[model samples]
Target chain A: MDKQHYVLQAKGVDISVNSAQGRLPLVHDLHLDLKPGKVLGLVGESGSGKTITCMALLQLLNPKTIQIGGSIQLNGRELNGLKPKEMRNVLGKEIGYIMQNPMNAFTPVYTIGSQFVETIRAHTPLTKKQAIELAVSSMAAMDLQEPEKLMRMYPFQLSGGMLQRVMIAISMCLRPSVLIADEPTTALDVTSQMQVLSELDRLRKECGTSILLISHDLGVISALADDVAVMQKGRIVEKAEAFQLFDQPQHPYTKKLLQARPMLPMEYEREKLVI
Target chain B: MNLLEVVGVTHTYGSFRSFRRKEKAATALSDISLSIGEGMCLGLLGTSGAGKSTLGKVILGVEKPTKGTVLFQGQDLYTMGAAARKHFRRDLQVVFQDSFSSVNPRMTAEKIISEPLENYERLSPSELKRNVAQLLEVVGLHADDMTKYPMQFSGGQLQRINIARAIALKPKMIVLDEPVSSLDMVTQTHILTLLNELKAEYGLSYLFITHDIRAAYSVSDALAVMDKGRVVEMVQDKDEIFSSQQPVVKKLVSSILPEHPRNRTLLNGDVFV
Candidate 1:
C-alpha cells in the first residue's frame, strides 16, 4: 500500500497528566497509522494508555490537566493543533467516535430519535425530518427491527446490544472517513459482539471507512483488525501485520499475551487428539 | 452424591409501577437443574440476560427461587433453619465479578480474610493474624500485604485477596461469578491456576459462571450452556462442547475468534451478517 493511503497517522504522540508533584507521563512516544478501509487494533491491558492514545487523536482529553505532544494527521492535514471550532467540524465530519459504554454516550431523558436529530443537525444542514429518515435507514441497515419504534425508545429502555447498535448507526450515518471505536463490544454479549463486529466490517467494505479499534480482548482484535499494535505500560512494544503478530510475536509481552489466552476447544482438541 | 444440586429452580423478578398497580413479574430463570460433583468444577456458560448469574445467586442462597430447591449434600438450602443455614453459609462461599466493589475499602486485607473466621470460630488475636498471613501466602500474595488496604493493590492482586477470603473458611464449594472477566489475560490465567491448586489442596467444588467459552474450558470439568433462562445443553465431556449442535451453542462456539492466524474461520462464519 502507498504511504499516502494512510487516512490517519500519528508520529511520536505523547500524553502527560499533571499530578500533585509534577507532570507524569502517561503515554510515551506512540506511533500509529490507519490505512484507508482497514482496521488497526491497539491492544493492551488496563492503564496501558491505549484509550488515551486514541483519545488524543480526537482531542478528547481535558487540556487543563492533560498535555498532548507530537503530530496527528488525518488525510495529511494536521489535527493536533487545530482550533476548538475547527476540531469540532473535524470531529463528526472527518472522524467519528464510538465510546466504550453506550449508556454514557447518550442522555437518558431524550429519545433516541431526538438525539439522532440533534447530532445530525449539529454536523450537517439536515432538517429534523431528514435526519430522522437517515437514522431510521441506518438502523434498518444494521438489521434492527422496527427502526421507527426503536427511535422513540429511551437509552435505558434499550439493552446493551441495542444501544451499541444505535451508537454505531449514529456514528456511521454521516459516513466519516475514519471511525474510532474504544472497546465497542466490551459491554455486549458474545452474540451481540459478533453482530457489532460484523456491522463494523460491513461499514468498512461499504463505506471504505478506516477504523482505529481499541480493545483488551485479543479475540476481538483478531476478528476485525487488519494490523495490530501491542502496547505495554504506555509504550508501543511491537507493531506488525495482524497475521504476523499472532503467528510469530517478537516481543516477550506479545508472546505472553498470546500464551495467556485460554485455548478454544478446537485448538485444545488438536493438541490432545494429535498426540 | 453430588456436592451441590440445583433442582428445577425458577426465579422471577417482580416490578410494581405504583402501589395500586399489580406487580408484573419477569422470569429470570426457568426450571434450571444441574449439579457439581465433589472436587469438580462445573462451568455455567451463557451470554448476558441468559440467567447464569441468577442461577449462581440461587445456588449461593443469595436469592430464593420461586420454585424448586438447591440441595447441598442432599439437604434443601432454602428450608434450612437458622443454625443449619449458618453452617450451610460457611460450607458455601462466593466470589463476585468486581473485586474492588466486593471488598470493603476501609478494611485491611487481614480483617477481610479473617471476617468469615471471626463469624464462626473463636480465635485469639495472634492465631487470627497467623491465619490471615497463611491465607495470603496460599493466594501467592506476600504476608506483608495483610496490612495494606484494597486500594493499594492491583486488580489481579485484589482478586487473589478475594480468593484468599473465599478459601479462608475451607468451604466445600465456591461460586465464582465472572471472577476473571474484569482482569487481563495474564491475571486471568494466574487466578485460574490458583483456583485449580486450591481445589486440589482442599477438594473444593466450584460453580464457575462466565460468558467467555475459553475461560470456561480452561477451568471447568463439565460445561453447561444456558440460553434465555434455560439450560439448553450439558456436556460432561469437555471435548464434545465444540460438536454441540444447539444453535445457541454453535453460535457461541463459532463466536470464539481463532487465536492463531492459520486457524482463522471467524471471518467466514455465517452466524454474523
Candidate 2:
C-alpha cells in the first residue's frame, strides 16, 4: 500500500529508558500501521511495551529520560521530533487517547463539565456556550445518561462505567483521525465493557475514525478488531486478520495466550454432584 | 456439614450519628442468606457496588451485620464467647482482589506467609521457615522466592503469595474476594487452577466472590447471582446456569465473548444487556 493511504504509520520504532547503569532498551525495532477507519488491536500481557508504544506515538513520554527513535507519520505528516508546542496542538486534535483507569484521568477538584469544556475549547476556537453545546452532544452521542447532571458532579460521584463513557466523550468530541485506547475496558465490568465497545464501534462506523486498541483481553479484541497484532516483550510476534489470528495463531506465545484463557467447566466436569 | 451459613444478614453503613444530625445510613446488604457446604465452592457473582464484598466481610466477621446470624460449624459466630471466636479465627481466612495492597510492602514473602503461623502457633525460626517454604511450593513458587518483597514479583506471583498466606493455617473456609480480577487472562487461569487444586487437596470450602462469570463458573460447584445487594437467582447445578431464566443471569452469561469472531454477540448495541 502507498504511504499516503495510511492514517498513522510507525516505521522501525524503538524505545529505551536511561538509568544509572546504562541505557536499557524497553521496546525493540517495531512497525505498525493504522489505516483509515480500521480497528487495529494490539494484544499483549503486562509489561509487553504496548502502552509505551502508544505513549511514544503521541510523544507523551518524557524526552529527557526516555528516548524514542523512529519516524511516525499522521496523515502523511511526520510526527517524530515535533516541538512541545506543536505536539500539544496535535494531541487530542489529530490523535485521541483514552487510558485504562478513567478515575485517575481527570482532576478530582474540577467538575466534569469544566474539564470537558476546557479540553474541547483548547483545540478549537469556540465560545464557552459553543463548547458546552459540543460537550453535551458528544456525551449524549456516547449514550451517557443525564449529561447535565453528570457535568455538574465531581469525578468521584460517577461510576466506573459512566466515567469511562465520559472519558470517551471527551476524547471523541474533536473527532481525531486516530484513537488510541489502552485497555479501555480492563477496569470495567462486562456490561460496561459492552457499552464501551459498542460506542467505539459506532464511532468507527459513523465517523470513519481509525482506532489503535491496546488490550490484554482477547475477548474484547476479537469482538471489534479488523486486524490483530500480538506483541511479546516489546516486539510484534504475529499480525493477522482478527479471525485468522484467533483461529490459527502462528506464534507460540499467541497460542499459549489463547490456551490460557479461562473457559467454562467442560460438560463432563459439571456432571458430578457436590454434597 | 455446612462450613458456613449466613441467615437474614443485613449490613448497613454510616448508621452512626454526626455532631448535629444522624447520617443517612446505606443498606449494603439486606436479608441476604446463603450456605457453603464442607469442601464445596460457592461462587458469589455480581457487578461492582452490588454488596458482594460487603457480604464477604460480614461472613468473615470483619464487620458487624445490622441484623443476621452467621453460623460456622454449628456455632453462632457473633454470639460465641471471645475464647471460642479467637479459636475459630484460625479456621477462617480471606484473600482480597488487590494482592499488592493486601500485604505489607515492607515485609518479605517469608514474613507475610509466616504471619498466621506466628500468631496461632509457637514455632522456632527453623520450623517456621520450613513451613513457609512448603506453602510457597504448594502455590507453585520456588522456595527462594520467599526472600523477595512484593514489588520484586509480578502481579500473578504476588497473588500466589497472598494465596499461600490464606492457606497457611490450613483454614477450613476461605473468602476469596475477586482474587484474580486484577491479573491478565493467562495468569487468571493459572491462579484459578491453583485454587481448585488446593481446594481438593485440603478439602477446603470457598466463598469465591467476583464479577467474572468464567472465573466463577470454572471452580464453583454452585453459583448465586446478586443484583443490588439481593440474591436474585441461584443455580443449584452449575451446568443449568447457562440456560438460566433470570435477566441478570443471562446478562452475565452473555458477557463472556465467544472465542471466535464468527460468534460475535456485540455486533449491535442492544444484545449485551
Candidate 3:
C-alpha cells in the first residue's frame, strides 16, 4: 500500500513515565498504521499502555511527568514538535477523540449545546448559530431523540447510553479524518453497546472516517475492527488482518487471548464444568 | 427443598431529592421470583439497569424488598430473628465486581480473609493464621501472600483474595456479582476455574449475576433473563439460551461478539472467511 493511503501512521513510538526513582518505559518501539476509512483494533489487558498509545497520538499526555518519542504522521503532516496553538487546529478538525467515560468527556455544569457550540466555533469559522445548527443536525443523524431538548439538558440528566451517543455525535460533528475511541462501549450494557457499535459502524460507512479502536473485548473487536493489533506489556505482540488474527493467530499470546474469551453453548467445554 | 427461594419480590428506590415535592418511586425489582437448587449455579443475566444487582442484593439481605419474601431452607429471610439472621449471614456470602474497593487497601490478605472467622469463631491467633494460609493456598495464592496488602497484588490476585474471603465462612451459597468483569480474559478464565473447583469441593451454590453471556453459560447450570426488574424467561438447560424468543434475550444473545472469525457475518451478508 502507498504511504499516502494511510491516514495516521506511527513508527518507533516510545513512551516513558518519570518518577522519583527514575524513568520507567511504559511503551516500547510501538508501530501502528491506520488506513483511511479503516478501523484498527488495539487489544490488550489493562495497564498494557493501550490508552497511553492513543493519548500519545492526540498529544494529550503531560510533558513534565512523561516523555514521548517517535514520529506520528497525520495525513502526511508530522505531529511532533507542533506548538499548542498549532496542535489545537489539528486536534478536533483533523483528528477526533472519544474517551471511555462519557461523564468525564463533557462538563457536568454546562448544557450539551454550549459545549458543542464552543467546540465547533474553536475549530471552524462558523458562528454560534451555525455551529448549533450543525450540532443539532449531527445529533439527529445519530438518531438521538429530541435533539433540541437533548442539547438543553445537563450531562447528569442523560443516561449513560444517551451521553455516549452525544459524545460520539460531538466528535463526528467536526468530520475528522481519523477518530480514536478508547474503550468506547466497555461501560455500556449489551443493548446500549450494540447501539453504540452500530452507530460507529454507520459513522465509518457514511463519513469514511478511519478509527483507532482500543478495547479489551475480543467480541467487540471482532464485530468492528478491520485490522487487529494485540498489545502486551507495552508492545504489540501481533498485528494482522482482523480475520487472520482471530482465525490463525501467529503469536501464542494472541491465540491465548482468543481462547480465553467466553463463547456460546455451541463452543462450551465439558471439562470446564464443575460437576 | 430449594437452597434459596425468591418469591414475588419487589424493590423500589424512593426519590429523596426534597420533602417539598414528591418524586415517583423507581421500581428496581418487580415481583421477581426464582429458585436455586442445592449445589446448583444459577446465572442471572441482564443488561444495565435491569435489576440484576438489585436482585443479588435482595438475596444477600443487603436490601429489603418492597414486597414478597426470600426464603432460605424454607425459612423466611426477612422474618428471621437476630441470631438466625447472623447464622444466615454465615451461610450466604457475596463477592462484588471491583476487587480493589471491596477488599480494604490497608489490611493485609490475612486480616481481610480472616475477618469473618474472627467475627464468628473463637480461634486462637495461630489457628487463624493457619486458616488464612490454607485459604490462600486454596485460591492458588502463595502462603507468603498473607502479609501482602491489596496494593501489592494485581487485579486478578486481588479478586482471588476476595474469593478467599467469601469462602472463609464456608458459605453454602455465594452471590457473585460480575466477579470477573474487571479482570482480563485469561484471568477471568482462571478465576472461573477456581470458582468451579471451590464450588465442587465445598458443595456451594452460586447466584452468578453478569451481563456477559459467555461467563454466564460457562458455570451456570441454569440461566434466568431479567429485564426492567422482572425475570422474563428461565431456561433450565444452558444450551437453550440460543433458542430463546424473547426480544430482550434475543438482543443480548445476538450482541455477543463472535469468538471465531469465521463465525462472523459481515454487514454485506458475506462470511468473514
Candidate 4:
C-alpha cells in the first residue's frame, strides 16, 4: 500500500488573488490528495474556487493579487517555493495540466507539430528530429487520425475534441506523476464531451496516472471520479466517495446542486409545480 | 388552423462564387412542419448545429425562411409590410440565451424593461414609473430594484428581468432560445419554474429551444427533435417522446435523458441520420 502513496497532496492550502477590485482568498483551508492510479473530482459552481485549488496544487497561482499558503507535495518533493523555470521542469514531467480551453492554449500561428515538439524539447533533451518523431507518435497514441497529417495542420483545423485528445496525449506521453484537468470537457458538445472524457478514462487505465478532475458539471464527475469534493464559495463543503456523495451528500451546497440538477428523462417534470 | 403552424420551412447557408456560381451549401432547417397550441410550451431539442437557433429566428421573423410560411393566429407572418411588421413585433417577443448581453449595459433595469413600452408609445412620467415597477414585481424582483443596473443582479435575476421585459408587452407567444443554458443548474430550475408560473398567469405560448433535453422535458408540454435541419421526430407528450420510432430521435433522446449510469455509454442502436 505504501507504493500507492499520494502523487499529489495539498494540506490546509489557501490561495488568494489580487485584482484592482480587491484581494480575495479564493481557496480556504483546502485539503486534498491524488493517489496513484485514481481520480479525485473537485466539484463546484463558478466562483466556488475548485479551479483555484487545482492551480494552487501546481503552484500556478497568479503572482499578483494571489497568495498561496500551505504545503504542496508532488512525488514527495515540496513545490511551493520553487521558481517558475524549476516549476516548469517539475510541471510537465512530474505533474501535467490539461487546461480547460484547448483552443487558447496553442499558438494559433504555429503548426500543432511545432508547438508539440517545442513542448517535448522543453522537458526532454531530444534532437529536433527526435522531438518531431516523439510528437507524431504521441499524437498517434492519442487516437488521432493520421498523426503525420495533423502535424502539419494548425490548431484551428482540429476540432475541440481532437485538440483535447492531443492535449491529453501530450500530457500522458510525459508520464506525469499527477494530472490536473480543469473543466476539460466544459467547452465541447455532448458527443464531443463524451469522446474526450472516454479518452481521459482510457489514459487513466493505460498509464495509471493519478488525476485531479475539476468541473462544475456533476454528470462528468459522476462518470469519471472515484473520490469527490464539493466546494462552495472558496471552501470545500463536503468530501466523500463518489457514489456516497452522489447518493447521500451531507453539505447543503451539495444537496442544492443535486436538487438543481436536471435528471435524465426528468421524473420531476411529471409531478405538479413545486418550488 | 393551428395556434402557430410552420409548414415546409427550409433555410440554407453559404453562397455561390463568381456572384452566381453555387458553392458548398448546408441546409440549416428543411421541410419542417409543426403546430403549437395556445397556452402550451413546445421545446426544440437538438445537439449543436442542429439548426435549432435558426428555426427560432425564422419563427420570430428575425430570419426569413428560404421556403414555407409561419402562420401565427392563422395569418402569414411575412405577408405584412415593414410598418405592419413593426406592429406585429409588439405581439411577438424574444428572450435570448445570453441575458447579460441582451440587456443594454448603459441603461438601468427600469429603462431596459420600459424601453419597449417607451418605444410603443410615450407613457405619462408617473405611469412609466408605475409600469416599470409592476414589470419588475411580476418577474419576482422587488419594487426597490427598479433603480439597479443589469450588472448588479445575478445571472438568475438577470434572466428574470429578460422574462419581465418579454412579458411586459403581454405578447401571445415568445421565442426562448437556450434561455437558461448559461446559468447554473439550480438557478435553471428556479428560472424554469418562474417561466411556467408566468405562462400560466399570462396564457403564453412558448417556442422553447435548447440543447439540454432534460431541461426541455421539464418545461415543454411537447417536443420536437431536430437533426441536421430536419424535425425527425416530434411528440405531444414528453413520455411519448422517448418512445420515438425514428432511431436518430431515439438515440439522441436516450443518450442525454437517462438518469442511470450504465456500464457502457448510450449507443446509437446502429442507426442515426
Candidate 5:
C-alpha cells in the first residue's frame, strides 16, 4: 500500500533519553501503521516503551532531555520534529489522547465545566456558550448521567470511572481523527471498562476515528484491536492480525505473553478442546 | 468453625451533623452479611463505589459499622477488650491495592516484613534476619532482596513483599483488597498462583475483594456479587456463578472479554469503517 493509505504511519522511529550516566535508548526502530478508522493494539509488559512511543508521535516528549528520531506522518504531515507552537494546534484538535490515570489528567482545583469548555474553545472558534453546549452534548453522547451537574463538580469529586468517561468526553468533543488511549481502562472497574471499550468501538464505527490502543491486558486487546503489535525491551517483537497473533503466535515473546494471561475455567476448557 | 463473620453490617459515611441541608449521608454498606469458614476463600466482587472496600474495612475492624456486628471467631470485633483486640489485630492482616504507598519508602524489605513480627513477638537481631529471609523465600523472592528498598522492586515483586509482610504473623485470615489489580497480565497470574499456593500451604482463609472476575474465581471457593452497597447475589459454588441470572452478576461476568476475538460476543460491529 502507498504511504497515503494509512491515516497515521511511523517508520524507523527511535526514542532515547539523556541521563547523567549517558544516552539511553528506550525505543528502537519502531514502525507502525494505522489505517483510517482502524484500531491498532500495542501490547507489552510495563516499562517496554509503549507510552514513550505514543508520546513521541504527539510530540509530547521533552526535547531537552529526550530525543525522538525518524518519520511520524499524520495525515501525510510530518509530526515528529514539529515545533511546540505548531504541535499545540495538532494535539487535541487533530489527535485526542486518553491517559491511564484520569485523576491526574485534569486540574484538581478547576470544575469539570470550566476545563471542558476551555478545551473546546481552545481547539475551535466556538464561543463560550457554544463550547458549553458542545461539552454537554459530547458528555451525553458518552452516556454520562446528569451532564449539567457533572459539569460543576471538581475532578476530585468524581469517581475514577466517571472521571475517565469525562476525559473521553473531552477528548472526543472535537472529533479528532485519531485517538491515542494509553491504558485508558486500567484504572477503571470491569463494568466501567465495558462502557469505555464500547464507546471507543462506537467512535471508530460511527465517526471513522482511528485509534492507537495501548494496554497490558490481552483480553482488552483481543476485544477491539484489528491488528496487534507485541513490544519487548523497546523493540517490536511481533506484529500480526489480532486473531493470528492470539491463535498462532510466531514470536517466542508473544507466545510467552499469551500463555501468561489468567484464563477463566471455561476458556481453559475450550483451549483444551481446541488442542 | 467460622474464622470471620460479618453479621448484618451496615456502614454509613458522613455523620448527620456534618451533612449540609440538601446532602444526605451516603450508605457505604447496607445490611451486608457473610461468613468465611476456616480455610475457605470468599471473593467479594463489585464495581467501583460499590462498597467492597468499605466492607473490607468493616471486617478488619478499622471502621465501626453503623448498625451491624463483625464477629471474629464469635467475638464482637468492635466491642472486644484490649487483650482480645490485640489478638484480633495479630490474626487479621490486610494487603492494599497500591503496594508502594502502603509501605514505608525508607524501610528495607527486611524491616518491612519484620515490622509485624517485631510488634507481636520478641526476636533477636540475627533470628529476625533469618525469619525475614525465610518469609521472602516463601513468597518466591531472593534472600538477597531483603536488603533492597521498595523502589528497587517491580510492582509484582513489591506486591510479593507486601504479601510476605501480611503472612509474617501467621494470621488466620487475610483481607486482600485488589492485590493483583495493578499488575500486568503475566505478573497478575504469578501473584494469583502464589496466593493460592500460600493459602493451601498455610491453611489460611481469604476475604478476597476485587472487581476482576477472573482473579476472584481463580482464588475463591465462594463468590458474592455486590452492587450499590448490597449483596445482590451470593454463590456457594464458584462455578455456579456462570449460570447466575442476576443482573449484577451477569454484568460483572460479561464484562470480561473473551480469550480471543473469535469468541467475543460483547462487541458487535464491522472491523473497519
Candidate 6:
C-alpha cells in the first residue's frame, strides 16, 4: 500500500467526559488509520467511546467537559493544534458528519429544501437556486424517487429512512473527502436500514468518499466496511480487515459480541402469552 | 377453563378534540378473542399501534374494554370492585421494556424485590429479606447485588433484577411488554433462557408481546400474528413455525432476518408490512 493512500491517522487519542455526572476518560489510547476512498467501520456497545473518537477528530468535543490529548492527522494536516478558525474551516469542507439522529441536526422551522440550500451555501459560494438544484440531484443519486417532493417537505414529514437519505444527500452535495456516519440506521426498520446502508455503500464506491462508519451492530458493519475496529471500555479491542476480523476474530471481546447476536430468539412464545 | 379468555373484545379510546367528531369511537381492539391455558405461552406480534399493548393493559385491568370481557380463570376481570381488583392483582404482574426505568431509581434491589411479597401478602421483615434473597438467586442475581441501585447494573443485569421483582409474588402469569427489545442480543438470550426455566419450575404462563417475528419464534409454544386491531393468524402446531403457506404469515415470517440462509423477499413492497 502507498503512503499517499492513507487519508487519516490517530495516535494515543484520549477523551474525558466531565459534567454534573463527574469526570471520566471515555476514550483511552485509541489508534487507527483510514485509507482514502475506503470504509472503516467502528463497532462497539453503548458507552464504548466510538462517538468520542469521531468528535475528537474534528475538535468538536465539549471543551468544558472533555480534556483531550492526542494527535489526529488528515491528509498531512495536523488537527490537534489548529486554531478555532482553522478547525471550523476544515471541518465541514473536509469532514462531513451524519449524526445518529438526523432530525436533531436539522431545524424544524424550515423545509428540507431551505436547510439543504443553507448547508451547501455555508460551505460554498453557491446560490440558493444552485444549491437546491445540487441537493435535489444528489438526493436523486441516493434513489430518492422524488427529490423534489422531499426537498419541499419538512423533516417531520419524512420517515426516519427517508430523512437518512436526505442527510446523505446533504453530506455529499459539498463533495467532502471524508464522511462519518454514527449508527445511521439504528432508528430505522429492517427494510429502511438495508435501503439507506446500501445507498451509503453505493456513494462510497462510486464517489470515492472515505467513510468512517460507527455502529454497535456487527451486521451493519459487516455489510459495508472494508476494515473493522471493535471497541470495548473506551479502547479498540480489535482492528483488522472486515473479512479477516469477522472470519477470524483475534480478541475475546469480539467473540463474546458475536455470541451475543440474536441467533436464538425464544421470546416469540412469550409474546403470545403476554399479549 | 383457560387461564385467560377474551370474547369479542373491543377497546375504544373514546374520541378527542376533533377525532371523536370526525369519526365514530376509534376501536383500538376489534373483535379480538384468544384463550391462553395454564402454563401456555402465547405470542402477540404487531407494530407500535397494533392493539397488542391495548390487549395487555386490558388483561391487567389497567384499561377497560368497550365491548366483551377479559376472564381470568373464568372470572370477569373488569366487573370486580376496586378492593377485590386490587387483591386480584397479586396473581398478575407486568414487566415493561426498560428495566432501569421499571425499577425505582431511589430503591435498592432488595427494596424493589421485597415490595411485592409485602403488598400481596403479610410477611415479617426478616421473612421478606429471606424471600427477596431467594428471588434474586432464582433470577440468577447474587445476594450481594441487593445493596446496589438500578443505575449500577448493566441493561441485562437490570433486567435480571426486574425479573426477580416480578417473580417475588410468584404470579400465575406475567405480561411482558417488549422486555428484551431494549436489551442487547446476548442479554436477550440469557433472559429468554431464564424465563423458560422459571416457567417450567413454577408452572407459569407468559403473555409475550413483541413486533420482531424472529425473536418471537424461540419462546412461543403457540403464537398469534396481530394486524391493525385483529389477530390475522395463530400458529397451532409447535413443530412448524415459518413453514406456513399462508400469505400473511409468510410475509411476517420472511420480514424477520433470521440466521437461516434464504433470500426472504420472495415478492417486494406489500410483503414488508
DockQ for every model comes to 0.57, 0.59, 0.57, 0.31, 0.76, 0.20
Per-residue lDDT over A119-218 for candidate 5, one digit per residue giving the tens place of the 0 to 100 score: 8988789999999899999999999999999999999999888899999999998989999999999999998898889889898888999999999999
Instruction: Name the better of 2 and 5 by TM-score.
Output: 5
TM-score of chain A of 2: 0.95
- Regions of model 6 farther than 4 Å from truth: A17-24, A90-92, A101-114, A133-159, A264-275, B12-14, B17-20, B24-27, B237-239, B245-273
TM-score of each: 0.95, 0.96, 0.95, 0.89, 0.97, 0.83
Off by over 4 Å in 3: A267-275, B15-23, B269-273
User: How close to the true structure is residue B222 of candidate 6, measured as C-alpha lDDT?
Assistant: 86
Tell me, by lDDT, which candidate is best. 5
Chain A TM-score values for every predicted structure, listed in order: 0.96, 0.95, 0.96, 0.92, 0.98, 0.91
Looking at the true structure's interface, with contacts defined as alpha carbon pairs within 8 Å between chains A and B, what fraction does model 6 recover?
0.12
- Model 6, B5-86: lDDT tens digits are 9888988886555744675577789999998998988888765567888999989898988889998888899897788777
**What is candidate 2's CA lDDT for residue B6?**
91
Could you give me the TM-score of model 3 versus the true structure? Answer: 0.95
Pairs that collide in candidate 5 are none
lDDT of 2: 0.90
Interface RMSD of each: 2.3, 2.3, 2.0, 3.8, 1.1, 5.6
Q: Candidate 3: DockQ?
A: 0.57
User: Can you tell me the CAPRI class of model 1?
Assistant: medium
Q: What fraction of native interface contacts is shared by candidate 2?
A: 0.69
In candidate 1, stretches whose alpha carbon ends up further than 4 angstroms from where it belongs are A1-3, A269-275, B15-23, B266-273
List candidate 2 segments past 4 Å from native: A265-275, B18-23, B268-273
Ranking of candidates on lDDT, top first: 5, 2, 3, 1, 4, 6
DockQ for candidate 1: 0.57
